[model samples]
Target: MSDTSDRLLGETTNERRASCQVAPGLTFTKIESTLQDGQTRYVRVLSVDFAAFTGKIRATTGKTVKDRERTSDMAGLMASQGLEPLAAVNGGFFDIASEFSPGALGGLTVADGKILNSAANGEAALTLGNHGTNLWIDKVWSQSRITFTPPGGSPSRPDHVVDGLNREPGRIQGCGGGMGPAGENDRNSHPDNLIDARMPQLGIHCLDSDETIVFTEDFGALPFLPGTVRAVLVGADRTVKQVSDTTSGLVAGPGEHVVVATGSHAAWLQTDAVVGSQMSLPAADVRRGASAETAVYFNGTDDAVVNGGPWLVKNGAEGPFDFNSGTTPEHAYLTPMNSRTAAGITTDRKLLLVVVDKKSGPAGPAHGLTMPQLAQAMKNLGATEAVNLDGGGSSTMWVKGALANHPSDGTGEERYVGNAIVVTAK
Candidate 1:
């Protein structure tokens, strides 16, 4: 942003007394502004000059789908994987209830080119593909299909279609895809279920009598659910190792995954799955207004993709990014003034991460920002395009393995989040 705009925010670039360089190309700035109403707003901003930066930015999830933790935990996990965590911020919205795999990512999330979850309708995503330099903030959607090829059968025409990946069989979290024949109360049917399904009356926990769900090693262990559930262990080489109808938790080994099914879906696993046949989840099928070229690009292995919503800025302008209020029930939640986290890309091609702190207590001075306020803030901060990430108690920022923002959680502590976008030295 220009020096004049910096002055407008009550801070100047030349006088970055509250800013520090977290890494060679990453800088963190803290802004404390007092409005005309005399309310204090705390904001943290992180900028990464990917164009010349010698670092890597990636999205990561906990070891399992049900795993949730602070941004530091997610960062430390990646640290064990040989990456030097430099900075991080909480990622997408997620399921917090126990029945639907509490930490299941709410929408499409691809980390290290692996599809962790399917896309949710009326949601926007930030995709960093074609290397970290090509950052995109758009209303993108995708579909995933798992095809099982019989022994000696061609992939072009698979024998059967698997239902989902890394999620519960009958529960479609965030009211998105993975709605099997018996899956109930999803957005497709009960439109209000888009967000209201999290409530008991919406029938979201309804189980599919016949469904197939593939759980990768990232999912940790297959929980032993009630019913006549059958499972087939598939190795990293795409070979079926074993098939059984057991109600026991089976931990998938490194580079291994298990396919669990019930009812007719299980029948295919019992009868058609030859021990040495190939079972695969091909590239996610890109759809919902995305161009054919965009589909091909997204399906290919790239960098990271994180889902968010209510576009803050687009194409260097304020948003026309509307998720029809008439149909999408979650629209009402976007306008309120609340603590928020957002990811953006500047016109000069820099990655921007922002976190706005909220009121801490009853008499707290911080009141947070409304959606329009956030959009203006992003544009004022030099963002050409941006999308809001998970906020409220889930809003957090970590630098050098330490908390960098005052979270709105009443306790002022970081909340266990579903995922995170982190940076590491090259």
Candidate 2:
């Protein structure tokens, strides 16, 4: 089939699959096929730049309420406005003041931040900060975005603000606060169950176990050749130990892959090449050239600024980036920024985009997208450079009422998470 035909149908015949061109400088070739439970699975060969995709997790709101019914009401409020619930509701909901709030975990909060006790266990709220921290309570008839400074000292224990959201399986591990059960020191433990941070080396089992290989990031390394491996996962730490030498070295480039072990066990393998490929608007077209200045905006305006540095807009469009209203599960109305956003500014000018897969409604699931499905969906979308962001209970993708992705967790429950990436105009 021709590229145009494939783009339209989203699939191609076996004969044409070998040389399918999804995007510029990206190609998909058939690798292998497998049948499970009477289902046929075909693995495709991917080629592209891995550095183009990066990941990030940012703290949005901190403290919130601790009311279950109020949290449920907040979910309905989000649904009515076309936003996905950020917390999970088991029997309860998330409460910002519930000792497990983001403020408790990261010691970060805004004076007039948005709060929603929409998680399963308690009430949840999301605040919008100003220059510093800001707090806002809609339920309390508050509007103006306020700002404040974070508290002085850190808390002693881990906060459980979004515990109800954490219980849901497939939810990213590190939603509510710090790395979930897997603390930062435990390599064998899961690294906060976020799609972007979900390192295969950190115990995130691949859907197609045969196609996935885990590796550590050795900054000082060369590129691995294609066709020698399937999919590759980079370690969390930015460093990798040399193959024959024990000396720790920096991975040469952002894209180079290396090998890493979890708790003395070979947890993941990495390749010094692109593990996947993606179709991005050219830097020139996106106005992300070397000379271009980076700008950030929230809610489609430049009024709400987070890190007002240089920005690389998609397709050269200033301010609001276009939404992917395409016919794919990965497509959504609002795209959240991943660590790639940070990397785009510091390293390559590439943007990591994500869509919240959940619905709005009092009767909707609270959680966002699951890990396995997200990984597979990204693969299917031809993402050569993709990483999972924080999802589940804390999986919130809100845009004034035009729902973007499907919420898998279901209604009246909110999912808690460590952080999130938001877009606001200053």
Candidate 3:
């Protein structure tokens, strides 16, 4: 840890009321009030200033679906890494009812600087940089693609990017890769969702400039290999210049960045990707999903972004919304439903995570806020820009190793989820 990280980890300010230094530049504020309806609501807001601490603030997905840990149990995950759980909230949408749904199952998911799953166009998404710095929220118009070039040819950006990194966890609870997990191909087989047939399951496998694959399978049946996988090589040109069917070790030259994708091949092979020749993947056409567009998320070397709908607040102005539209937005941006979650950046360039708690039951106080109310609440909090995240029963927050709110699941339990935005002091 640098001086900044040290200062942030060690600094404690006890002078504030209902607020304290949860992390370096991070502050926790709780707002409690009783409404005229005799309902009491609880709101815990995390305020972060990027300047104080010296580490990283990230939105990371948990283990793949089959081997998933309870997302509401942020403390357990934090303990596994020997980290302090500053705060955490569920992430993205997924095949909630399926046991075989893969981890980071749906929406756009990029963890630890790797693009594990691309966003669907029209869907909302959040993108981030590798260092967990640059942050963006926007409406994703493109899913994902692979553009590559051979030894010497105009950039050959392929039309398709690999669909995923593994089998659907919702479809097959223990669909491990290799000959061991026989149904790996059978789970979640779609034309769009894909994993390399040879690699077994799908995932984002990283490689350094030297083309050294740095990944080890945690749950899937596939064994870890340095270069042999569904890997794409990014070179000095910063463009993916090559795609390999079986192994990145064969395609990547020394000193190149590598990325490996996993998913079912039944869906991915639809792209007709090639390797011997030159190729480059251009942004694919944006497709609309059942309710809205599928979102995209990315972790670049220096920025992060997630997008959905028109800007809620930018430069301190509310963009647009219709409280009485009598209909939900395509992606439910302004839904009046309760248990809404929002991520934002303050005008002063700080990070904000807000979860509006809904009244748990007839006896609970806060029922949660609607679209317009949620947006306005963000504005009042001084958020210059923000975007809505998956909520409803998915809306739960964890701090210091415990759920900080009443989960609407009624089971008094954390919903087992595909992914989560985990903030840590590591």
Candidate 4:
């Protein structure tokens, strides 16, 4: 075993002995946190076992070739030492390559004279343009349903929301695409509250009472939507439910307007619902007197967000919520192509989530996390379902332009994308 592995094992053994535990179900054997760049922020390395799968977490960091190779080597070393690398196939890392090009990140041509690469892999570097932006790498996914919002921008605007719900009715069971034009075509069909020139606004929040809610707006107006509204509510006990203007006694239709709700315990709200409300308050209040806008309130019942009976809330607010941190103003987000299923050796588990943050440092082969490292990072987070988010120069996450993760290209540029994930009010 390599020195690192040996030390990790020794540490695990010592921890087990000290804890005086017998047959612990799942435990962390090793944890290594480091700051690669000159910045104070560092990435965390955790070696964990869930009694089913074992892996490590890479915390938050930019992509780098050396880091990627090192991560791959580590996976190999783990396998050779009798430790199964959960997602690593045959002791080798598995990467989701872009279908747009062979071994190349997915690319797109934007309305402006710019080229956007939304499906870049961990092995590639990001390049920013004068007006171009990169995508983010942080994401959260569940079975066939996924939601991701963009990062960093003005207030009262959506980050970006993408959801993949099953469309077919038991056709393939738990297999479908995003919730929108695609979702409308699928079996798990759900109404899209907002649809217009502008994309829909997406936001998540938790009430002081320990309930989670996700909000979406109409998509008729660019930068603004009409009277459409939809929401997903979650309880403090990790129970999910749905809440909307319909349930809140608010007038629902189709037009561009802001929506707001109030609660406590900031993280209780999923994403940046606080930020979304902050943005929508003034504008929405102006459009409709305190009476009309206020009418759309969050009713106490948090059972509307439940999927199948009850499941632990997977994506909640806890990580970086603000876009205007040290990261860039642009963030890349991801969603699943379809829901997952079990088909022989291949599981239909598609990761549908969004991660948007700015490119922090310079761009090049030495930036960001490699495919292997990313997988390890997910494993460390105890993620049973995870996938590579949009990356490369198009890999950008921003809060009003404050860079987050290290940029693959040092130019501090924003790459265009087919679409983005933004957090906004109802």
Candidate 5:
């Protein structure tokens, strides 16, 4: 790494620490401490200084629901792709259980500039430019759309909005997307307990009667069994190849996409989307809450993005929790002390992957940390902006060729996550 003294948080100080340089610009550090309450805390951080780092820090997601992989497995996959795996941590929240299709992430996700999934409302996500040079943490919104024109139809007609990319239609996992006329955020086909005010409509399978979802080759084959859902298959040439109501044995071929719709949307396809019609699927439009610039720059721009929330710290302090009134007893989601994984960027532009170990075994004395505590920890580590990633049993850290933290999973095994943020050197 660059000067170790300058990069670290001053190791010679009061905390017990173990540090190692994983690569030219990557360093892994572990801090062990006993809180005033006598609980032990284990904190692991993977600090990346892009100026000295020779690789890229990007997000990786599976192409299929059954493709979920452990943190180490993801690292191995990166290695197989010819990039040296330096460090990695679990990504955003996802639908671990879904009656339709499991593993649909809760928020926006992009890998190597390709939009894997759009944002979940205006959820906070940690965005990074190629080579980890540019980074932004903010609430973002995005949507995919398709345009089709008949032989004699006007080309100026409006484009049809795509509800989701490569995911089950209408069955929103995390309840994202903008509110509709009825103030419905997403169709909640499987609403369970109210996770919190921020996620009242959240569930494993939020259903919508009429919606459109686009499926690309990235999703592998169509993930649905026998169902009433209808789809329009479009070739790379932008021609409608076929329209089928059959949900079985269907897959989007190379440079092709399948537009799957339900209810009235299906009817629109059966009519307007007849065989031989012209169609075009453009890059998704994404916008950051704080910027007027088109967030679509994130698509295919050599940048990497991953989903996370709510904001732990913004501009060097605890940020706003507009979705939840932290003072209310009903909003207990952020108050509990739980194992946490957070992604942050320092004022100087250095990237930080922070993982807090919960008291899963006798060796780990830390009972985890509350959201506020996690924010304070990120601030203490010099992060001017940060957001919490998927944690709990999913919180994991892999570095220097192996798992580096005690996964809070009771058995100590890492969970198969929807995605991960990894540092790799080509």
Candidate 6:
């Protein structure tokens, strides 16, 4: 953003100064509600100078339940990371109420550039990555597609890109598959049932591509080649968004073929795919109308990156980000109320981590702030841009082995989670 644009955030940088600075750019402050009845209602806020500590602020899914830790015991999991945090919070929605082994629901996640989960096409998202010189929040889009046009024939295309490479039978409505099959109502679908699902969704990862594109499902300690692999036909709409999903036996003839798999269009999409030749799959959301080479004619795969969110703030003004609205009876349901955790950027280029304790009182501001309230609080903190992370029982914060917020689970208790955002004193 330009200097003049930064000034538009109302020049409230450091509006509520931190009481202490423990690291280079990490500071902590205790904010009390300025209301008469808000005497007992307060929040713990942490601020980081993103430019000063570029690459230090990050989002993480601490550990995968692998079934054992459907919710990795939160506090225990944070302590295991070994990096102290200026403040931390639960991240991304998860499979807390799903048929599959619980973990991060659809929040795209990539640590060390290793693809853990990929966001759904055009889903609400928040991203943080380096622009070479500085690590800053980014706006990235995930597009799912496997396109191919046969010789002198029509083309076949799939609309969604699913994460995780598990053909685990039984699909949940809005769990890992995303808000598509769920039909727009963010909270309407039954967590454990499959309603309008596309059958045999094609999965792609680097492994599914030419050996030239290395697949790094378990890229531990390995120099990641994220850009090297343009798009991996990782998994279908099942488990995680990052690896090779169950393949729908693509038996091929030496000559040519074309196929398209869409859940909403038809139950079964069968066609032939020519061996050694598919359409070229390219990156997404890079520019307006700039699509990956969709006509590699079945020669492709799309990228999966970052976590999901209901963007709270943007470009020095309120953003139009929502996960709930316009439902088709099949995808409308009530959303749960709980504590909230959010991330934002200040006018002066600082990063803010705000965690509002849940509503415990019978009602009113005495209870915690609702999503709208949280957004206002972020604006009050002088944030020019912000996004909501996973919250509720999953909401948490850690600092040098000490828990900062009064976790709602119990008196100073915590709920295990699939992931956590950490602050290491690099």
The TM-scores of all predictions, comma-separated, are 0.81, 0.26, 0.60, 0.23, 0.87, 0.58
Clashes of each: 0, 118, 85, 111, 6, 38
Report the lDDT of model 4 for residue 83. Answer: 41
Residue 229 displacement (Å), model 6: 28
Worst 10 contiguous positions by lDDT, candidate 5: 1-10
Residue 366 local lDDT, model 4: 25
Worst 10 residues of 1 by lDDT: 198-207
How would you encode candidate 3's per-residue C-alpha lDDT over 15-60 as one tens digit per residue? 1125667777878776554455566555567777777755556655
Which predicted model would earn the best TM-score?
5
Q: What is the C-alpha lDDT profile of model 5 across 1-426, one tens digit per residue?
A: 122333222322234667888888888988766555666677899998888988888788754632567877888888888888888999887777754455657677777777777666556788987676558887677766677676666444347777777666766655654522122344444445344322322222355667888877776767554445678889989998888886556778888888887876776776667788899777777777643244447535558778787788888887555453122233454777888999889988899999988866456466687777788888888899998888888899998688888888776688888888888876
Candidate 2 per-residue lDDT, tens place, 348-416, comes to 222223333333423332222233333333434443323332233333333222222233344524444
The TM-score measured for candidate 6 stands at 0.58
Q: For candidate 5, give the lDDT of residue 242.
A: 86
Model 2 misplacement above 4 A: 1-59, 62-348, 356-373, 379-384, 400-403, 413-418
Give me the candidate number with maximum lDDT.
5
lDDT winner between candidates 1 and 4: 1
Clashes of 6: 38
C-alpha RMSD of each candidate structure in angstroms: 5.3, 22.3, 12.6, 21.7, 4.4, 11.6
> How do all the candidates rank in terms of lDDT, highest first?
5, 1, 3, 6, 2, 4
Angstrom error at residue 139, model 4 = 14
Error of 5 at 361 (Å): 4.5
Residue-level error in angstroms, candidate 4, position 231: 26
Instruction: Report clash pairs, candidate 5.
Output: 40-365, 40-366, 113-300, 187-207, 189-206, 189-207
Model 2 C-alpha lDDT versus the unseen true structure: 0.24
Worst 10 residues of 4 by lDDT: 303-312
